[model samples]
Target: MKKIVALVTLAILIFSCSNKKQGNMLVQGQIKGLKKGTLYLQKMNDTVLVSIDSVKLLGDDTFLLSDNVKDPVMYYLTFDGNTTEKRIMFFGEEGTITINDKIEQFGFNPEVTGSKNQDIIKEFKKIDARFKNQRLDFIKQDFEARKVNDEDKIKQLEDDYKRMMRKRFLFTAQFAKNNADTEAAPYLALTELFDANVRLLDTINNSLTPKVKASDYGKRLQKFINEVKANETK
Candidate 1:
């Protein structure tokens, strides 16, 4: 009887171990167009993309990615084979990765069939937007801190950013909402400083001194402005 019990226990252990494997599924599909003709499904904010995993693309545009996904995580579909575009992050589901449109739409398209986890995905998107603004405010704050020469205050602001960046999208966005006014002050100050900097830059751009005419400093200032404008989100 004891030997039979041991065999049963061993079988259960083997089955449990198999079920507890490291990964979940990743469903991939390509709607319209071709070339590489592949799209990637991956967990959001995660480093590596699962290439060797089993992903299915069906005739009706439904797909499944199966691995033992660790937990419910923020995941997005990326078209990295051609260009750098990431679909919105949604709470991952093993059921399906749906794409309605035949071709990829780089920007957010509300009508597009997204993850099986619809509500969670929408919430993730909302938080993502809010977090973006929160960080933008931080940029402005940086300029202000420098202009006022407030080293201590700058450190505090920097520390806050450090802490915030460590959090997930939802938490960070919620935190931003709660401390909206308090957080925005630094960014506003920075924006003012950047404006002043730009003014100085403009005034000096058209007229170069004997020393200025000798080098590319004027052009460099203009380049800096252009770069900043390009990178600044909204």
Candidate 2:
């Protein structure tokens, strides 16, 4: 009787531990060439970034962190290496995520995996980079025109810059509209298009499905739109 009771107790404990691990988000990463430092896992609560877990490294560059994540959301990985602090953002989901990078390029060039939203963000960023590069080219042309004291050229460059900005806004609106069922839709609006024209923002908001509207980011987007409209009326 004692042996049977002990076996049952051990089985229950193993099952409980397995369930706990499977129910939470696991982030395991390695920072190569890092001899000493602290890595922090952080998330935003309203307006503040709060640390949820931290690991101090002495000789090993590897660390693991886990947290209960109810939905896909943004999280930050911050490293303090006694010299400088570096931070990078990623979307955290309920599964194992792997990150690997050198300490020198921790935030700049880390290989991250396991979140679908992060993949979407990567695609959007490529489009955004092209727009930014075009804006920079316009700025350079404007400077050249100013040096030559050519009013007509300067005016043309200014008009081009304005058109580029309008195009960027339209691209963001279309991206959100086409991805309304994904979290990326609301995220793009909240981060990139909050200051966009109210009419355009409304069109993106209307494109979201009922389920997407109830998500955390979706709710925040709705609140932001309301605030922008209120400010316009004021």
Candidate 3:
């Protein structure tokens, strides 16, 4: 009976080891102050978010999740399958990526590392925030001008707004073209320049490196450009 029990235990261990998840990319992180929760590593699958791997924490805050990354793409780290809120979004690629955040803050601000695309995104956000503030200021000015019925002021504000928008669009297109070798190039063009002229979008798309053009975001950018062009012809 003792020998049989030992054999059964060994078999269970072997089975568990064999079933362990292995992949090219590893996402490991620690959520400080978290005692218990479930962490899920998710990615988009044909417009649907799907979990690739998950870990349940019983008395610890450390977690490990991984997936077979074919190309650099955006990924989400969420708790308890609740991706709708308090989720950390990062660019995922081959190799190990480390993310560290406080459970109290969660996704508000996470320190993500090991992805070059993410670095570019961080850089762009800083400048983009300035543009956002300027836009808000313009909105307030426009509202005041219209309230006072100042036609000359309103017309000047309108012209200024148009120029600001043009500047923003040109900045975005140039930024994308500057980093055409990275997957983030197409992503930026798709997200930031989507409403811009088709010519600007085409310029950014045509500047993408071959490797980047083959990435997930690259394909999406191309498809979006085609759709816009088709609409113009209609």
Reference-based TM-score of each model = 0.37, 0.85, 0.89
TM-score of structure candidate 1: 0.37
The global Cα lDDT (0 to 1) of model 2 is 0.84
lDDT for 230 (candidate 1): 71
Count of backbone collisions within predicted model 1: 18
1 or 2: which has the higher TM-score? 2
Report every candidate's CA lDDT. 0.47, 0.84, 0.91
Name the weakest run of 10 consecutive residues (lDDT summed) in model 2.
14-23
Number of clashes in model 2? 0
How far residue 48's Cα lies from its native spot in candidate 2, in Å, is 1.1
Cα lDDT of model 1 by residue, 117-179, tens digit: 355335445766766787899889988998999999899889988765655323533432332
C-alpha RMSD between model 3 and the true structure: 3.9
Candidate 3 per-residue lDDT over residues 146-224, each given as its tens digit: 9999999999999999899999999989998999999999999988988899999999999999999999999999999
- Model 3: how far is 170 from its true place, Å? 0.9
For model 2 the TM-score comes to 0.85
Clashes of each: 18, 0, 0
